[model samples]
Target: MGHDTVETPNLSFGRGRTPGRSTPYAQYARLDELHSLQHPRSKEPAELSFIVTTQVMELLFDLIRHEWTIARQALREDDLPTALAALRRGTHAQDVLVESWDLLGTMTPQEFNSFRSLFGEASGFQSAAFLHLEFLLGNKNAALLTMYDGMPDTQDGLVEALRSPGLYDEALALLARRGLELSPAHSEQRYRPSEEAAQAWRRVYTEPEFAALQPLGEALLDVAERVTRWRQRHLSAVKRTMGGKPGSGGSSGLTWLRKSAEQDVFPELWTIRNEL
Candidate 1:
């Protein structure tokens, strides 16, 4: 049979005579429930854009975290190609996340202010999914997990992630398996750049025998750079809309975000470049 002439099955939906019968896409996606989530506090036209943008960012955060988890698991299994593929997908998702601000970028300060007061104690800092993404990227901090204490299920998930092996941990483990000496404490604690870690990567970059690690290192750096760009863009967005005002959840606003941007994830990956 010619390719274009191949017959495809058209199964009947069997959604009896109801005028508003649900389609398979809607049933699988729960799109009606998803659309119902955007209950803006005010009738201001800009509020819908603001709400939808925030929701989209949240979904992207989850997407990135999911990819990171897959990469971390692949590394644990010594599957470098799978891990690198997943990390590359994560970078693309982060790129979308960075551009998501453009939606809100269209709103003026007055438009944001119209609905800002309605946000109450809510803030991006309260985003469990973003925190999960950070945790998978090895930005562990038990103190920050306290924010979710009010929600036991969320707090438990954060606690589990806090103790679980992170992406950096898996990377270090892979290096160790390849005969490099490393302390388990490196994974047990929040990741910090160390001389040994840098030398390990230097070997990967410099020695032909370990060239395989180079792509993984570069993939991780890609993720790190995208995250930094996101932080910078987020800071700019906040400054443009809110000025120096305190963030909704008692955060120090721009000062806090700028400091966060300074703390680079995958620190040793960047430092090793100087040696190369």
Candidate 2:
């Protein structure tokens, strides 16, 4: 007693369209556009590996930044579980980022030289996304903004990130709110370890009543450890591929990386351990 109803598919573009144009996956991911972006300046096949690896790392950097932003906001709201979940996700992304160096770890000096000239003054150090990550991690260095002088939008974003409270700052504020005494962190300045922060974290590790806060401390330490590993891997990769050369983008290369590798992410997180 009912009439059959059927939905008609849209056929204005025709059914024989290429997969790149018609597939839902391709349209959502913009596969065709992504594939079109690679234009290798050098004919050397190894260059493709370099380009792809760099691009993948850049994407991962943004992804990690996204996770951290979520985690930071959650921490501000005292949502420990959400913050921890986001940090765990960010650490997983960090693991992928660390492993990504394997794609370039074995490149011989000869292979690198083939395309090194093409990079002329361009360097991974100039990545705005990575800089955003650094700022979120409390490594606020305003001088680096000069690098983006030609990119007003990027520089503006960096300025805002630089001025905003970093992940650790939010965590510290949460600790203070929870009755732990700590000095207020100035988001625009580079982070320094405070004895007050050290004492607060020490309580988190040692006091039975503060056991709930231990996981937050551990999560932060996990993030810090992964960041250190990323830096170490980067240093090792550069040393293996091009020993002691001045870096692209006017960086000191090995010297700069060595210093960076020595610097701790979330300094108080590690320093507190000695007291614990």
Candidate 3:
């Protein structure tokens, strides 16, 4: 038996440093700047854990957003290879995010309580970038846009994503182009399943053409599964640490996060899987 993986070479900048051996990785590596970060409000040792976990999550979220953007762009240009690379990035980032929750899990109730109030009305729900990423993934909830209202860049970005058809929309459209008879009813709204899309995907899986696109579909599914896992793991962490207490940012904490955990990233992509 044999296996294959797609490799997308990146433009990693390093000056005369060996790939496998470096005395101080950071010294040899490139960093834009870190001067503005790591400002822990409380002088508590545990506060560092809370702040670092949040920052790590934010970084992972940024990577997810980047990959989804690449995936969307790939669909637009009919560049499935590029799209697959982007989706793979999201899949890898999802693993990192789940681990971040594990880091937060180390903070016991007493540890969290010391610095929880310092967070003020700032909960993960209020993360505008995260919200925009959700909308880009085809989850449109108008109410979630409220937090971005006063912030122009975030508001504009999310509003644009909401109006635009998502990555899956482009994929279904591609299937239609590839001769799937997608009924208008199937795609009208609500991210419902498409018989045509499913059939086309089935053909792709059963008799794959455009060899790279096979991995494209798989990569998308991988990303979806990993993201869902991250959510589920985070919810477990929250429940373990805080129980049903309200979130520091004013939401209904664990209960509210539980509902968010159910939100799907690419709904139709998963629906097509059963038919395949």
lDDT of 2 by residue, 1-276 (tens): 379878564454434554544557667887667876777899888899999999999999999999999999999999999999999999999999999999999999999999899979899999999999999989899999999999999999999999999999999998888878876766687898888888898888888878899999999989999999999999999999999999888899999999999999888879877766
Clashes of each: 0, 0, 0
Which scores greater on TM-score, model 1 or model 2?
A: 2
TM-score (C-alpha) between model 1 and the true structure: 0.90
- CA lDDT of 102 in candidate 3? 74
Put down candidate 3 lDDT per residue, 1-276, tens digits, no spaces. 258777554335334445553335444442423323678887778787777788878887888888888788788777777787777777788788887887777668877777778878878878877876776666667767787778888787877877777777776666566655664222223465556666666777766464445676677678777768877887888888888888777888777777768866556556666766
Local distance difference test, per candidate?
0.86, 0.90, 0.71
Comparing candidate 2 with candidate 3, which one achieves the higher lDDT?
2
In model 3, what lDDT does residue 231 have?
A: 78
**Candidate 2 displacement at residue 212 in angstroms:** 0.5
Q: Which candidate achieves the best lDDT against the true structure?
A: 2
TM-score of each: 0.90, 0.92, 0.78
Q: Which structure among the candidates has the greatest TM-score?
A: 2
Score residue 120 of candidate 2 by CA lDDT. 91
